[model samples]
Target: MKSQCKSVVTIIVGAMFLFAGMGFCQEGSEGKGGSAEWTKVIDSKVSEKIGDKGLVNFEEGYIEAVGIGAPPEQFYGKPQARPMALRAAQVDAYRNLLETVQGVQIDSATTVKDFVVESDVINAKVSGLVKGAAVMNKTYLSDGTVEVTVRMPLSGLAKAVIPQAIADDKKTDMKEHKPVPFSKKPAPADEVYTGLVIDARGFQARPAISPKIFDENGAEVYGTLIVKREYAIQQGISGYARDLTSAQSNPRVTDNPITVKAISAEGVGKTDFKISNEDAKNIRAAKQNLTFLQKCRVMIVLD
Candidate 1:
């Protein structure tokens, strides 16, 4: 009887250990699985900050799009005829109209401006009279009051009539969410902040001026000139990242942003050239569209 009791106790203890081992294995698998990859992806040097900064963990997020009403053509007709002339005219008219009626109550103003008539062209008849596009201006005051000014084309009166009516109906729906006025003092905690919006679109990053920098051909350059500029991430975004972490964990966010400074082109003659504003704009646009995946990889090194 004594031997049998000891055998039973041994079996019970072995079973408990087996169960515990299985549980630990399951936990280990989970810890090494899917979510672990997210950490690694973020940890890679391309996106990571150097020198013990906090890691960035992304929460599941959603992008919500709020439509500020489509342009008139999309509302009325098919988008098959989006020629540049028409688009240009549309934008020009919209801007002009906004300026003309700056402070009028949108619902109460009932004036009209004339641009070109699309219907005449649509009907295959040439109406020699130049028809201008209608205009409407809306203003919102500091006290959450809204004002509107409208200029309807003679032929557009029909279309114009409905918008003001809709505006009238939706007046109550406008919530009082105006931004707080600018202050000499710091904003209260809950305000959204934006860093200085530099129009660096075409602005190439140049090396900061250094007193003792030299150029190619072994000539001592008096001031620091832009050498080579790799691409750089936005400062505001990286600054936010730096603020998120402290020194306690494996890493924390750093206060400084990573930048790619320009380098000098060795042995190249100083060629002074001027590009047109339009060309500069195009260059900026092109640069903005350049692939950022490579930048992400480079940032991983910093991480």
Candidate 2:
């Protein structure tokens, strides 16, 4: 009877090891579409971060977090240890994603956290979205630890939050904010432009969900006021890239695009751009290109 009991204990320990090995096999491709999709969008020019909070990759159109976890004491001596650790890791990922998301800029003046704090409805919706973020990758360490990476689309977050920021009266006003028609060009009608690009490299401009562009004189050049609400909620107010080449090549601004220089970064978040009056007038006058602005086909190049 003593020998039989010892054999049973040995079999249970072996099974736990086997299960832990299986968890290790899931590394780099454990969930959703795996880490490939995220990696595809990355390049040497862009930066990546991982820690208590994750990162917001505007170029990739998403925010992501990496969660670390270990087996609970109760799971010792059982085959379920690794799985419990994975669950804990997922919970950690969710919390980290929430923190990273709350830090995302909604505009120069506010963040997602501000909206959440002001409205219970927004808080609940944001929490739901966090739960819905995709688990992109998972890894199991030989020392019996686990890590999970999760991602959430920036567009999804904007769609859920932007509506709440706009009032019915404001929506009516936005409808009337149409592009002005101008005939003179800043330089020349050099190209039949399909989109607009703002080179704000030295201005220290940053990304935002609803950033705007203004002329030196303070006239609005681009923002939610001139954008179609549906488009704004889908593609975001604009696209951001690290360099001019990337910004011009971005799908957000295809074909021949009109590139303008930003004289200053406006507002506290540095999301709003102040372009020369000549550039602003040229953009508004490029009637053929104004159509793209309405569709949110704009890109901003930042350092």
- Number of the top-ranking candidate, with lDDT as the measure: 2
For this target, which candidate reaches the highest TM-score against the unseen true structure? 2
lDDT of 2: 0.71
Model 2: residues >4 Å from true position, as ranges?
1-51, 74-78, 166-191
Give residue 122's lDDT in candidate 2 (0 to 100).
Answer: 76
Expressed as tens digits, the lDDT of each residue in 1-303 for candidate 2 is 345333333543343334332332245556652234445444533323433457777766778877777888888658988777877676666667777787888878888888877766777677767766777778777778888777888778888777765443155434443434544444355767878898988875777877788777666788766677778777777888888988888878887788998999989988888888888877877556567887889998877
lDDT values of the candidates? 0.22, 0.71
Model 1, span 1-303: residue lDDT tens? 345333333443343333321211221132221222434544431222112211122111100000011225433344433222233333333232322322111121222111112122311111111112221232223332222221222222222322222333235322321111122343333422211111111222111101111222232211111111221211111111111122111121222211221132221211111223332222223221112211211111111
RMSD of 2: 10.7
Model 2 residue 251 distance off true place after TM-score fit, in angstroms = 2.8
